[model samples]
Target: MKYAPELKRSATIALWLILLTFPIMVIQVNTIENIVVWRWMNIAGVGTVAFVLSFLWQIYQHRKTESPLPVSAHLPAFQRLLADPKLYRPMLIFIAAFALVFPFTASHYQINIMSTALIYIMLGLGLNIEVGLAGLLDLGYVAFYAVGAYSYALLNYHFGLGFWTLLPAGALLAAFFGILVGFPVLRLRGDYLAIVTLAFAEILRLVLENWNALSFGPSGISNIPRPGLFGIELTLEQSAVYMYFLLIALCLLTIFVIYRLQHSRIGRAWVALREDELACQAMGIDKTRAKLTAFALGATWAGMAGVLFAAKTTFINPASFTFMESAMILAIVVLGGMGSIVGVIIAALAIILLPEYLRVLGDYRMLLFGAALIGMMVFRPRGLITPSSRTYVFQPSEHQERT
Candidate 1:
């Protein structure tokens, strides 16, 4: 049976409902600060109560009505687009503009927040390559990040190497590490793979903390040099706002690389490997090579981000490369949609920037954040921007009929 086409005049109100229910509730939670005097525990307590009440009310309404809240109200194609941007052009411009002017804010706090956001954006895109494009569940992503940051920091500290010289080297080293990681995990799947990756990240963190001779042993390498641009050494005098442009350029370059790779021959092979490894191998696709390449490429991107991060922070500690960091990066990728670069970028922004910006709400922030994440996942499991059930329809092969 054919699915009914959406009516011409109807609108897609599903998203609006979600935004209204969760985001507006967040606004309310922020608004009612006086209702909770203790602040920290108060907000959490209040939000929890409110959520329970709302949930109970929902149950009550459903029991009484014997129906869902609302039906689908789809708009015509042109009208549907009017609510959203025209694919990625607007998003690209949105990203460029935000990255460009965000640095110019008079507030140092904003600049600091945005710098973190840019780093996460890079991290999200890198993880998107592995988990999103290749369908690999990696929990040890921090190892590559650690590898890159440490490689750059140690190289510069020991050899007086410049940031530019060490960035590529760090990426190459991370890629090497990625190959090492992939070899043993070829047979692991799902939760098992995630556990192994998590173990790897923890191991890297422990090594960094314990290896005093090489890693400086938890004291961490401090006073790291920032990247110099065009022979001009970036100093405190350069202003945090100005340095942001360098980050913007780096992000744009990362975006370009991802775009090229997504449309490349290797990208196609990775997608094939993602869909089904046995089938990919049967089709003469070297599944091993494809998986390895995906890992390497993903690691390379994270490594580069780590190099930039080392330069940006000018200090590193074992604490920064913890498993939580890996989980946060993975959360942005998964919450944003695995294969969608734009979704990852948006998720990165929301995850990093939104929490900081919402700090004005004070104690209620994390409570609202947890609620928002849960609501987002419940409403759109695929991600914030990614479509659900977009199938890759391949025509029947000559050997398929016989099989």
Candidate 2:
């Protein structure tokens, strides 16, 4: 006897759920004490909920059909206003004004959090070039960020160089390293490329962790200098505000550069490469150059962000550049709609602020966050803010109309 399709699907979903949740629930680590804690109850609760939801969702989808009704055009006044093209400029002006005055009205903690969110926004924009435009699956993008941070850290620690002087230097060095990594993997794509990048990041982490003479091992570099305006050193509150403004500038610069590039010939090539590498190559687009260019440009942004991160934190460590960091940045890009600057800003804000707001959830914060991410992927796989292309209209000639 054969099982029903729904039953088979439910069983498969339940099996996968068990496999994914078992390790995290069954094996827990206490980093401070180096001990393990087991929580079977949590596992059981999560697994049961996941299985039930998956089964119900599958059934609903299977039974669902498309509606025959036409879409409604008579939206609410607020929704209509938002949809109007004429209102875009005014809306943007209002948003900019709000952002400009936010720090003045908000608490110090909120200001600091927004600053952190801006850094991730910068990172998301950088990765958008590689993964979003060029279709490169980079799991080790944080390695470039690590390079940027370490470059500044080493320069400050040894040579006593200031943040301003090292800013471009860090970006240039990271771009150079990007080319070095890109050259070897120019021909690879998809999972193979992802695996290589992941390995590259892990190698960098291990080297930093073990190289005590160079990186100071796990203890990391300390007392990194912050950016000073003119000759005066900024206080802690002043520094936070300063960083916020600096990040806004950097984010704006990123937006301008990406916008210009998106309309340029190189940008078109990148899009073609993303859509179909084989077809792009057949059309005389050099795959090697495009891939390397994307890598270099993307790395440049990550490097700049690293410099700012070092200045803000006044410390650098191997642990700061981890796989989880890469994943977070990737999620920002995906959730924001890849290649969209405005979407990236919104996604970055949500990713950074949502957790802070949900702090009351305690241990359940991560669980809820995971569930939300899953829901987003299921409902809006493309992204929350998909980019739309511009439209052009032309009038027919009088002669053609008469004919």
Candidate 3:
């Protein structure tokens, strides 16, 4: 009797889902043959799945409310395992070994996919600094990415600059653009800031798309040349291997730098600003500098990743830097757990590689992916690994002890 209301609610939800999906799932039209096919079974299937999912969701919510355990007890098992050094250290070592050997053993196609995943990891971490640490929501991070790529393409086309030379140049140019965008949005926060950043990115993309002479228009620049190794020429396969190793090195460097920065004084300022802008300002932290630094530093990694992206693909196009790219990068950060270095890496790999591996399911792969994401959001809103709180221990100084 007590469960009757819950059951009714679930039924209602299932019915709604069936009604919503009826047109798409239950009916198929053949225009050439002038035929309409009805799959009534799809209605039953939708209802059953929706009912079961909704019922399970309600039960989970009920249990959560009734449970005697503290809120911390609900932390995800993966996060708990990560907190134990005994587990995570060995896991890290094993993963590192695998990553190093992966390029050698995996097929060239797989290596390329892994390289793309690494690039996203770089992008995720960079955005983490801005959105996760600084609480600045940037919807146009791909703009900086485009800047780095196009910088390499244009400079190489006209001035004959090499990858090694343009790598740092691309990053610097992106950082300069970051500062330029940051200056206008220093006072904006939340949605307003996101809008401004997104606008900036769109404007850049439009310029590149329209400026035929400068960017070569929609055709894009091709044969941009892969990264050279000490003036030595290499075959295509060898070049892929080199690019894979280069990405590994860059990802490591990015992780190290971000980890260090996360624990630094300026990093603390960013966190404080994120938590409370008014309070942070009251504490004498320079808000303008913090905001600008966050934007520039965060964009720096994207710029570097962009250079590598252009080199690996040996091409540059405005279409590649669309809003969807930004959304995916943002999804990596959010799904991984904001402000978590390890979480972002894990999320980036999973999000990028899962679809490739699930291609066996063909069209249904994305359906499964979408369902998984929905489940995650419903069950674990904080992400796979919640960022651990900073712990400080007090130790008496020698002078105080003497006194």
Best by TM-score: 3
- For candidate 2, report its TM-score: 0.82
By TM-score: ranked, best first: 3, 2, 1
Give the whole-model CA lDDT for all candidates, comma-separated.
Answer: 0.78, 0.86, 0.92
Across residues 324-370, which tens digit of lDDT does each residue of candidate 2 receive? 99988899889877777777887899898898888899998987888
Q: Which residue runs of candidate 2 sit more than 4 Å off their true CA positions?
A: 1-83, 389-403
Query: Any runs in candidate 3 off by more than 4 Å, and if so which?
Result: 1-9, 28-37, 66-72, 395-403
Listed per candidate, the RMSD to the true structure in angstroms reads: 9.5, 5.5, 2.4
Better model by lDDT: candidate 1 vs candidate 3: 3
lDDT, model 2, position 395: 85
State the lDDT at 146 in candidate 2. 93
What TM-score do all the candidates reach, one by one?
Answer: 0.77, 0.82, 0.92
Across residues 1-403, which tens digit of lDDT does each residue of candidate 1 receive? 2212222111223333334455333433435565522234434444555555455545555554775434333222422443466665675688567666655644776776777788889889998889988888999999999999999999998899997889899999999999999888888877898899888889889989998999998999999888887786555736466556667777888889988888788887878777888888898988778888989999998998889888888899899998878888988998887787767887898988777877999997887888777877875687865533335889999899789
Q: Is candidate 2 or candidate 3 better by TM-score?
A: 3
Give the candidates in order of lDDT, highest first.
3, 2, 1
lDDT of 3 by residue, 1-403 (tens): 9789889999999999999999999999999999999999999999999999899889878987897677867787777888799998998899989988898899999999999999999999999999999999999999999988988888888999999899999999999989999999998879999999999999998989999988988789998989999989898888899999999999999999999999999999999999999999999999999999999999988898999999999988889998989988998999898999989998999899998899999999988988877777777688878887698899999999999
Inter-residue clash pairs, candidate 3: none
